[model samples]
Target: MEELFNLTYKDEVEILKDEDDFEALGDEKYLNHPDMEARLYWAFCRPNGSCEAQIKDIDPLVSIMAFNHSKLNALKRFTLLHKEVIENPNLRVKIKNRTRMLFRSLVDDDFKELNKVLDIVPVFLEVAVDQLKNGRKWNDIFADEIEATIFMQKAEKFIDDSFKEALFFKLKDLRELDQEELKEHLEEIIEKKEKIHTLILKHYKNEVDKWIEKSNLHLLQKMTIKKLAEKLI
Candidate 1:
């Protein structure tokens, strides 16, 4: 079961060898003792460190690090995970499910910590597109219509125009499913896709309006905006 492989904060701490034991001494003392924690953090973070070599599978570790205890810590871990995922083909394969799960969590959480590391959003978006292209289930990609619409509102700016087009096209394809398949929570999928489509269009229109206002063009500006919409959508 996936739960068997899932790691919690406690599970991650235990993997630090003596972290749990050290923490049991006292919360204050454990918090003050940075040397040991620093060493362990580095051990786990470093690409060539012993921890990396010892852990044959990094899926759970990556998942835990993605949504770490604090925004700052998660930002740091995300930077390292991004590097590893980009540099190591093996890591990319191992991290696929966990990465999708991270996206789902971010959506469900309304992207609370995403502003801390906006640059990393693109990689998550890329992973999402990869999953969709590989025929991953809709539920695996998003929590539900409400959570997904929140994502469209908050995280849509980070999504590239091409990615939006691909997502829209795919969602449209999903909508075309027959009535037989519609019985299985397909309506939720339909609602999610429709909301996302509308949000994207609204974003595009708002962007064009802002551009037009900034450029201070008259009738010709409207023509330029039309061209821009043609290119963007």
Candidate 2:
């Protein structure tokens, strides 16, 4: 029994060490050790020219860093790095180079590390979907429709079914609403149809119509949240 337990313990430790090795390589290869700037650059860049791209690109490195260190200083360093990028446009070339190096390292140094990066994809996807439901701009929600669809496709990976269902229901509610009734509700909310409320209702109606035409339930839900937020603004 003792030998059996020892063997099991050894196997567990080996598994953990393998995980650590993957994480450490990610930190070195992608994050650019001792240089937070490089890390932030890698985190923010997107295939398209936009800073608002979901941090999903760098989430793997970030998650590994968080797991290894779990320290406030590390978190602060990352935050500052992101802030610096936000403040400086001149660093774009340098950042892009770092991203290239990081990608190269994965291909040339340790191909297995590439799998580690993909491991956190589901988690990042969950974050992106949650952001959309929490009222982020439609375009700002996910990196693209592909990412969103990937998340939806892997619904079993989601931990919070209630939240997901709530978002779905919210969208469904919007899609099912009577356009005439929505117009009346808008008038009641703003106390006049000739005011900004009328314009808002018109926009909402158009957006809903577009969603219906496209049969994009997720987008319809997001538009519903946007319409609700406009009422407060």
Candidate 2 residues 69-169, lDDT tens each?
22222122223233334234453233443333333333232223323432433223343334334533322121222222233444445535554543333
| Candidate-wise lDDT, in order | 0.42, 0.37
Best by TM-score: 1
Clashing pairs in model 2, backbone N/Cα/C closer than 3 A: none
Off by over 4 Å in 2: 1-16, 19-81, 93-176, 179-184, 187-233
lDDT of 1 at 76: 49
Query: Which digits, one per residue and each the tens of the lDDT, describe model 1 over residues 1-233?
Result: 24524664345445544455443333332222334443334334432232222222244333333323223333444554535554566656655564565544443333344433345645465554443334334443323334445445545555666646444433323233332342233334334444544654454445445554555346774574445444433
lDDT of 1: 0.42
The parts of candidate 1 lying over 4 Å away from their true place are 1-76, 111-118, 129-233
State the lDDT at 178 in candidate 1: 34
TM-score of each: 0.30, 0.22
